[model samples]
Target chain A: MYWITVLVVAIMILSALAVLLLPNLLAAVAASSVVSLALSVVFVIIRAPDVAMTEAAVGAGLSGVILVLALRRLGLWGLGDDNHPRPGDSLQGSGDDA
Target chain B: MRNFTSLLFAGGLGFFLLVLAADLPVGAAPMVAGEGILGQGPEAVGAANLVTAVVLAYRGIDTLGELSILFAAAAGVGLILSGMRRRADQRPDPEGGFILLAAADLLFPLLVIVGLYIVLHGHLTPGGGFQGGVILAAAFFLPLLGRPGDSLNHAVVNWVEGLAGGAFVLIGLWALAVKGDFLAPMLGKGALGSLFSAGTLPLLYIAVGLKVGAEIAGLMSTLQETEAAEP
Candidate 1:
């Protein structure tokens, strides 16, 4: 149990760092979901199942989808460089400067 | 140098917290209120899940406040993005492809069933209204995501949220009229862990579930609609 806790916490921290450090916004969003997933596991380990369920549903699930939708709307949903957006690839016709 | 200083400060704060933690009890969580609640909560609220008892009975008003906040947030989103949606003629995003469509169709019913089960059995389980409500919202949103052209009826969404919020308040008022305290557990708390148990707690959770589900669905649809209207 203690080892499981340690492993989950390690994964949570690593994924949290990946969320910050990853250059791609989409990858970062996925990393954030991993962080939330590991966090839910941590919550379960600590016996706060209510909190774990909320974190899994909202943090890992809805929040990721919302962020992805927003990213797509902003036309930032791409597999390219973080700094420069490709021309004509943006569905909304421009970069998200707003 | 500035970054180094900031990192040093963060490390110092962390060390200070760890040092403070080292002095505290390891296994024993000095649960003063928790001990009281564990001893007397079942008798007072009669829910099998003590967390539900605490959430719906003891901190009922706090839950009401949370509901109000969610309602306000949904309304605020509507107000802010009210005019920012695409016209009917303008094309929304295409269908999310075959895989998304098939998966959405498959998951909708299952998600709905699971969500309802979680919300209804809140008194007996680890999940409750808020968690279940989000899953319900996701279930509703997935269809829209698969086929963005078929828009959600905003009018219906508005009514559901409004009625759900009103029902929550009305239930609280009923409790007040009967017991002189708002949201106090009445309705006889039938049997522990049973479907009809926990007095007004389950009713409150149902109201909470519907309200949250509606609010989140509206929020997501509004966001999805704002895709083509970006200025």
Candidate 2:
């Protein structure tokens, strides 16, 4: 049972990483949340409901919100109508000064 | 561009997972520790919850050390943010975006009450000092967002911390003085799984919770004051 749980968690973590590196920050955040929830489930199986609750609250709840907020702060999500050449262009230009 | 690296990473992880799965144990049972100290015995140490027993009885000193570590972290946050402060004459308008303000107001009270509930029932249920304390800290953040100018009075925080600290010490001392061992259950352990069980553990958790809440709140207020001062 423990091994199965571990295998499930490992798969979730790998999937999360795949989501993270797929060039979409929102997708990455969602993937990370899945990983956290999976780990929390594993914690519950191990009879640590308190730890599972904390993980779900901190890892899934707070972290997802924080990630979206940070993404917004960095100007990732915006009005869909704008024709702005992806903001990464200006960011790359700024990097050239270094 | 990033696909090749990601693919390699994924492959490596898969290989590692296979290796770990190959080494699985068949069936596991609940772990038992210190057969004489934990199981049926004369001096059962009074606390019913085994986790609480371990925390407050067998490893009281370790818990004390953990509390000290948290204290150090809170102090470090204060020190780091204090030196980077702007001149007092240049305080910015405390107002932030409207959404942040309204959301903070709505969440603060709920967080505080829930945090208190968690702390009070820690001995009976799953939560304890650290979790409850963090929840309390989160509650304080909302107010900081909604009203940056209205700073949490450091004096009140300090007083609460001092009183809690004092109570913790007093209880420990009482246990030592009466029972000849520090942190021995001074009060009645009560029925198993009851709210009033675990003797001093619940009270200790409450003190630790208040201290943690105050420290985190102070840190939030301090950081906000500094950031609000920033452009």
Candidate 3:
């Protein structure tokens, strides 16, 4: 049981790390949801069905929607850094004005 | 350039996780069942779930502090956003489809009712304060996204919060008066799996759910108002 738990925990931790480390913000967010869902499973295994339910709802469900909303608010949903100004624009003084 | 910062953040997080794994138990927490009413007292604390018992009875003060923290955050958000109010720059959705609008309107009350049900039966079932509270906030938020200019009445939110807080304290005091112990079980301990078991835990979870819902809704409204005010 302990070894299985360790494996699951390691997978969750790695997935969460990938979520943070990945450059694709949406992928990162999806990874975060995966991590949360996995944690809920862990909670259930520990005889905390209530906590597991709460974790799944808030951490996985609500927060996923909220993060997507936030990402939309910030205009970071689909487009990537391809639209950013060329690095030389810093010398052109367009960088600091905003 | 942004990727560099993200990488650094990831590395730092990984380091922290390693430290946590080294220190904390990585396996299942040892489950030691609490001595039931026979060892403690008559189980009438207004809850049926033992988890609620640990949440609101054993750690009542901690839960209170958590609620206060949420309240403070709500207040801080309101203060910060209300001061920055301007004019609405974004125009209301003129092309809002009838289907979308109707769906939102139809779902709002149902969501609120479900959230309230979860809050009310927190101790009786597998839901509780934080979960129901967040759901309640979402019920309000869903409409805000669909209907542009709609806003919550701040007064109603204040009343909800005030009443919930007062109820929590009053319940605790009543326990003290009746049982000679603050936060003691006040209701009859019915059958072990019944809804009326576990004394005061259910009541506390309800209070917590209401308080948290009010706080989150208030915070969301404050932020939304500021964003709406921005032109």
Candidate 4:
């Protein structure tokens, strides 16, 4: 039980750091979901199953879907793709035709 | 410099939280003289789940406020997305695969049943309206995954939201009329572990579940519509 708790806490910390450091917005969102999932596990360990269910459902599931939808709306298909130019970046002269 | 400032702020907050945490009991403390909420809550509220007793019976006003907050957020999202026009080029696939559509159809009703079960059993078990409502929303959301352009009936959503909201208030008013306290359990709490136990709590949770489900489904529809709209 102690080891499980320690493992979850470690994962939570690692995911939190990943969310902060990951450059790709989608990857950051994924990391954030992992953080939420790990936190839910912690909640379960502490006997707060209700809170755990909510965190898992809302934090990992709905929020992740919303974030991905927002990313799609921003025309960000994937990592390092220049099809949709981000704001404030230098224009590469009609790359839309490329 | 910005990083240093942020680090300093975070460190200060962490220290403050640690100090607060240090004051709390590490594990289950020996029962004290005074009867705590956990000790007396079930008998008082007739809810097997102490958490439900506290949330719906003891702190109902807080739950109402939370509902209002969620309503406001959903309303804001709807307002923001109202002006967007659907793009002709971005229409969802008209002929979604048979398997995808079939799966969505198969899963929808099952999910709804599970969601209702959770909400209805809130007083007796660990599940509640909030979690069940999200599940309900997810159930509604599944079909949209198969057919992205298809939207839930806004009029139906609005009606459900309005009626559920009104029902919650009316239930509280009824409690006030009967018990002279808002949100007081009206009907007699049945057998401790029975389906119909917890008097008005299960009813309130049902109302909450419907309201939250409708609200969240509406929010998702609005967001999906915006996604389908022209940039």
TM-scores for the candidates? 0.90, 0.70, 0.74, 0.87
- Tell me the spans in candidate 1 whose CA falls farther than 4 Å from its real position: A79-98, B228-231
- Which pairs of residues clash in candidate 1, taking residues 3 or more apart in a chain or in different chains? none
Best by TM-score: 1
Off by over 4 Å in 3: A1-11, A72-98, B1-46, B89-102, B228-231
Candidate 2, B1-231: lDDT as tens digits: 598999899899999999987776636534466575557422365554466567666777687777778678778978877876545676433355567777887888898898899888776677777678878877866666556467778889878877876777777888899999877676766666777776788888788788877876676566555533211
Tens-place lDDT per residue, model 1, A62-91, is 999999988977878742444554332464
Q: lDDT per model, in order?
A: 0.89, 0.70, 0.74, 0.86
**RMSD (Cα, Å) of model 1:** 5.7
Worst 10 residues of 4 chain B by lDDT: B88-97
Q: Tens-digit lDDT track for model 4 on B49-110?
A: 88898888888989999999999999988888778735667654243456778999999999
Clashes of each: 0, 0, 12, 0
Better of 3 and 4 by lDDT: 4
- The alpha-carbon deviation from the true structure for residue B218 of candidate 3, after best TM-score superposition, in angstroms, is 1.9
DockQ, Cα level, model 3: 0.20
Give the candidate number with the greatest lDDT. Answer: 1
Residue-wise C-alpha lDDT for candidate 2, range A20-83, written one tens digit per residue: 5778877888888888888888888888877877787667765575565445434475423234
* lDDT per residue (tens digit) for residues B1-231 in model 3: 898999899899999999988987657544455555324433444355656766787667777788888788788877866665435675432323466678888998998898988877777777888889988988887777666477788999999998998888889899889988777666766666666666666677788888888887777665555533211
Residues A1-98 of candidate 3: C-alpha lDDT, one tens digit per residue: 78778877987899888996899888888889989988998898787899898888788877776676556444577322255543333435446656
